[model samples]
Target: MITCKDFLSELNEYLDEDCRDEVRKELEEHLDECPNCWVICNTTQKTIEIYRGMDPIPIPVGVHDRLLDALRMKSQIAPPA
Candidate 1:
């Protein structure tokens, strides 16, 4: 049997329905037998769904170039390995 810690750690994948079938079955069984974990799983699943449903916002133009430039400068300033 999987422990509560393992169940919680992998709960996100289960909620996302992105885990392996065997793992999903284990989580399903755990959720069925454990009310606390069930509540936690339900709440997290809802939260992720809500976030995913939000509309995408466009990033300002040049932001990517600016970030790359900053990273380049930072890397240049550091000593060589």
Candidate 2:
């Protein structure tokens, strides 16, 4: 059985369809048994679908910089050099 941690670790690859068949099967099984993970996966998939259908809009530089700064602060990560 795949743990939530394992599911999360492979999430990006799974979403990208880059995981092996065996791993994909395990992830599917995990999603079936885990409601929370299922919600997360479903929401993310839908979000991606919605975004993919949209036209790209450029953000204003100030807003973009503030967004990045906020994300960095939230993650407690240092800014890139």
Candidate 3:
């Protein structure tokens, strides 16, 4: 059986339905016996479902530009000596 840590590491791939069948079986088996992991996985799946159902709201152009500018400025900053 896979450990909780293993499940978490593959959580994103499993959630995305990008995992192989063998991996999926192992993850599902873990979820079956572990209540904590099951809750987390179930909740995450539900959240993803609702999130995907909603229409995406675009951020303002100004906000986008400022965010990009901040990233660029931060990247260009020299590390402290």
Candidate number with greatest lDDT: 2
Q: Give me the displacement of residue 62 in model 3, in angstroms.
A: 33
| TM-score of every model versus the real structure | 0.63, 0.63, 0.65
lDDT values, one for every candidate = 0.84, 0.90, 0.89
Compute the lDDT of residue 67 as modeled in candidate 1. 77
lDDT of 3 by residue, 1-81 (tens): 899999999888889867898899999999999999999999999999998999978999999988877877889854356
Candidate 1's TM-score: 0.63
By lDDT, the candidates rank as 2, 3, 1
**Can you write out model 2's per-residue Cα lDDT over 1-79, one digit (the tens) per residue?**
8899999888877888677888889999999999988998999999988988898788999999999999999999999
lDDT of 2 at 16: 85
Clashing residue pairs for model 2:
none
> Relative to the unseen true structure, what is the C-alpha lDDT of residue 37 in candidate 3, on a scale of 0 to 100?
94
